[model samples]
Target: LKGQIHGGVAQGLGQALMERVVYDRQSGQNLTGSFMDYSMPRADTMPDMEIFSNPVPTKRNPLGAKGAGEAGTVGALPAVVNAVLDALAPLGVKTFDMPATSERIWQAIEEARA
Candidate 1:
């Protein structure tokens, strides 16, 4: 479920620093339209991820094994965003608005340049 991991992180990143879904006042429609119009995380934006967690729980029927699903997504969001910040730290780019689009990144880059 690489898609799930990626998608969850995308959602988390949206919640973290980007524009989230909100109602359109005039048309009463969703603000985010198509995938292209949407602000999404890009491939080069994130660093490698390290995932780890405690063993499956044992609370039900002597076998409380936790599901493997949702685990990766749970682990990936923070790691990816953290890596981005870490990469930009040396440039004094400490803050960002998310989904970290090229436009936003470009603005940050320009700000850093200034």
Candidate 2:
């Protein structure tokens, strides 16, 4: 169970920070056609993850079941995005899109300063 949760959170963080599918504008061809060209989250790139849980018994079901399969990925994307935006707030940045790479972040800062 712990492993599953960790894997899910890692996957979620990857999608939030690094995963993107690029395409050719003219031919509509997939630009990210190879794994080498695509960016995936690596162990060195991953953030420290801390998870906490509190289970509550439900009277409606005898099993007292709760679904958590997609919880990690579902929560991570927005959390990461919000964190980025917040960090940049002091720099006069208010809006940003996803997959906020280093280049894009630098560009946003430059644009805001100008």
Highest lDDT against the true fold, candidate: 2
Candidate 1: misplaced stretches above 4 Å? 1-29, 33-59, 62-64
lDDT by residue for model 1 (49-112), tens: 5444556576876666545555455645576568778888788787677656567677777788
Q: Which ten residues in a row are the worst by lDDT in model 2?
A: 1-10
Q: What is the C-alpha lDDT profile of model 2 across 6-109, one tens digit per residue?
A: 66777777777777899999999999888898887776766676777787766788898655676677777788888998999899888765688887788888
Question: For every model shown, what is its TM-score relative to the native structure?
Answer: 0.51, 0.74
RMSD of 2: 3.0
Query: Lowest-lDDT window of 10 residues in candidate 1?
Result: 46-55
Return the lDDT, model 2, position 95. 73
- Global lDDT of model 1: 0.63
